[model samples]
Target: MSRKLPLLIAIVVILTGSVYYYFTFRRGSARTIQTFAYLRDPASRPELRMNAYTQCGTAPFIFPTDGLVGFIWDDSFRPGHRHQGIDIFAGTDVGVTPVIAAYPGYLTRQPDWKSTIIMRVPDDPLQAGRQIWVYYTHMADAQGNSFISQQFPAGTSEIYVEAGTFLGYQGNYSGDPNNPVGVHLHVSVLKDNGFGKFTNELEIENTYDPSPYFGLPLNARENTDTIPVCN
Candidate 1:
């Protein structure tokens, strides 16, 4: 027991701290790397961002979260840079807000960042049979080890999950504990090119309009509802 004191302390720290990383918006340079950035509408608020994050444009999909909240799809973050994904503000803090698998498929974390989760849904209608990779980032509660990886581990870096399986929580922890973003979920999807390869999500052609994917209007700048999902 004495020799294992260090291990015990680490476990307690993870359990108590909730293990959130917020390296930066890039999910850390080494741990990058995906989308979900938008300019906030002055008329509305952050809730709109959350709404865009969860809802798709039309049928065949619904808002991933309980309901629409702060902000959503806004491509004005940088000049000529269109936001490829929707930003969802789901949690009041770090560990409490859980994000589920949008569609059942294989689960894997980003290259260097365990906080950034990538899910491969192999049966996307948009893709003939190439598969779609749902990229989930900004997990404020993710440490070096991922919730999905910790729960399901194998030799390969691939872990399969159900359509609505519990992926992890929605957080703003990027890749370092020192940096924290606005505390939201950056969700995006990409075309899978087989062999576990995926197209670049930042490239507009490489990304999908999550609005149609989630069955909601992400471009709602008219301000109808606004609440701090990140509250």
Candidate 2:
């Protein structure tokens, strides 16, 4: 049949160029742009500042137990709804301690994201994926086997965390402390309301309220939000 019609038109032109290279080059090369002059966000759009980053707040602190950051939607699953991030109470064990990189860049992974640490800032070309995530939900079992050291049975890795190093330890993995009472450390920061805003898969409702990027300055017993004058 004419050589099977040129092998079915070369397998439909290589499956239509792999679905047009997965939406124009793998989801636009997993978009990344915020490249540290200090992870910018001066209220976002100033023509989207292609440089001079400065959301500067977290760059440091990652404690796993100093408590008092609150924001828990898992108040046994949603008693009052709020939890977008920040928990640190680490008590029930698994305290191998050392999860940093509050401000650096390039390290991504997302498998329903139960274990995460993303910080991308490819030199502020308008801070592309403008990321910042650190979620280790009650990670017992030797801090989830010391965060993907290798042996990927579907564990996801590329664990390069350094800007404060030590990315593992502190467990409870977000539940079951005799019906949930203690063991914390949930720290988080990931604001996404730009770049084609999202719909659902809940990035904390497209986050953007990380207590003013954790620069700390609200004391009515904390959590009044918006306090990042990062200078």
Candidate 3:
């Protein structure tokens, strides 16, 4: 009886550990795990790609770039860290995938910004009378060399760009050359400050879920398992 009890105890411990691992790692990072799988085989998902300036279903905004959406808005990397935007992995070498404007607006690239741009939408497409800002970043190499188009230079502001306008290419700039991110585009829909400028984009509260804009399930919390694709 004593030997049988010991075996039973060991089995219970093993089962408990397996459950803990699934809930802590697998379930918690299901989206991220699936993203890496898609990155390895982007061609497997075709519904996500369409002609530039074309929207999926009733989405107001067009697909900004062709790639597998790796991460999504509100995705948390750790405790108290919420991702502010959706990361579209190009699944190609840096500067190979082209990124375009999702909608028409006044584009601005700060003077010190090496791989970032912001577009001001006078009226939010989802909400009338409310202004929003479309922010794009990671358009640079690890060394901070810009990949943005020559048409919009540093300090360029208030330039009206049409939807599908060539903006730049994706890169792996993580601000630190030693720890460069994967080649991808991080885009967010930012809330406009009452002063007619964009609010802090790093904060989750200042960003909007891109689902309504792109008409896809771009929120990480909602979609897990597979890459987001239009039905």
User: Which of 2 and 3 is ahead in TM-score?
Assistant: 3
Q: TM-score for all predictions?
A: 0.61, 0.24, 0.85
Instruction: Please identify model 3 stretches exceeding 4 Å from their true place.
Output: 1-28, 41-52
Evaluated against the true structure, the overall lDDT of model 2 is 0.39
For 1-231, candidate 3 gives per-residue lDDT tens digits of: 987999999999999988755544443276677677667787775665444556899888998987877778776666457789988887888999999999999999999999999999998989999999999999999999999999999999999999999999999998999999999999999998899999999999999989999988877667644567777
* Candidate 2 residue-wise lDDT, 1-231, digit = tens: 997999999999999877754433222111112211112333443332211123344534323332233332211122223445555442224554434444544455545443444444433223444533444444344224324222222345454554444445455543333453344456555543345222232445544344444444322123233221234
Off by over 4 Å in 2: 1-79, 84-133, 136-154, 164-214, 218-227
Worst 10 residues of 3 by lDDT: 20-29
**Between 1 and 2, whose lDDT is larger?**
1
Per-candidate alpha-carbon RMSD to the true structure: 16.6, 18.5, 5.6
Q: Could you give candidate 1's per-residue lDDT for residues 1-231 as a string of tens digits?
A: 899999999999876555322211222222111112222332333333343224343344434443233344434343345566766654355666667766667887645665677777767855456678888776645343353335633232577777667766666675665666765667777866557688887776677766556655543232122322321
Cα miss at 80, model 1 (Å)? 3.6
Q: Which prediction has the highest lDDT against the true structure?
A: 3
lDDT per model vs. reference:
0.54, 0.39, 0.85
Candidate 3 or 2, higher lDDT: 3
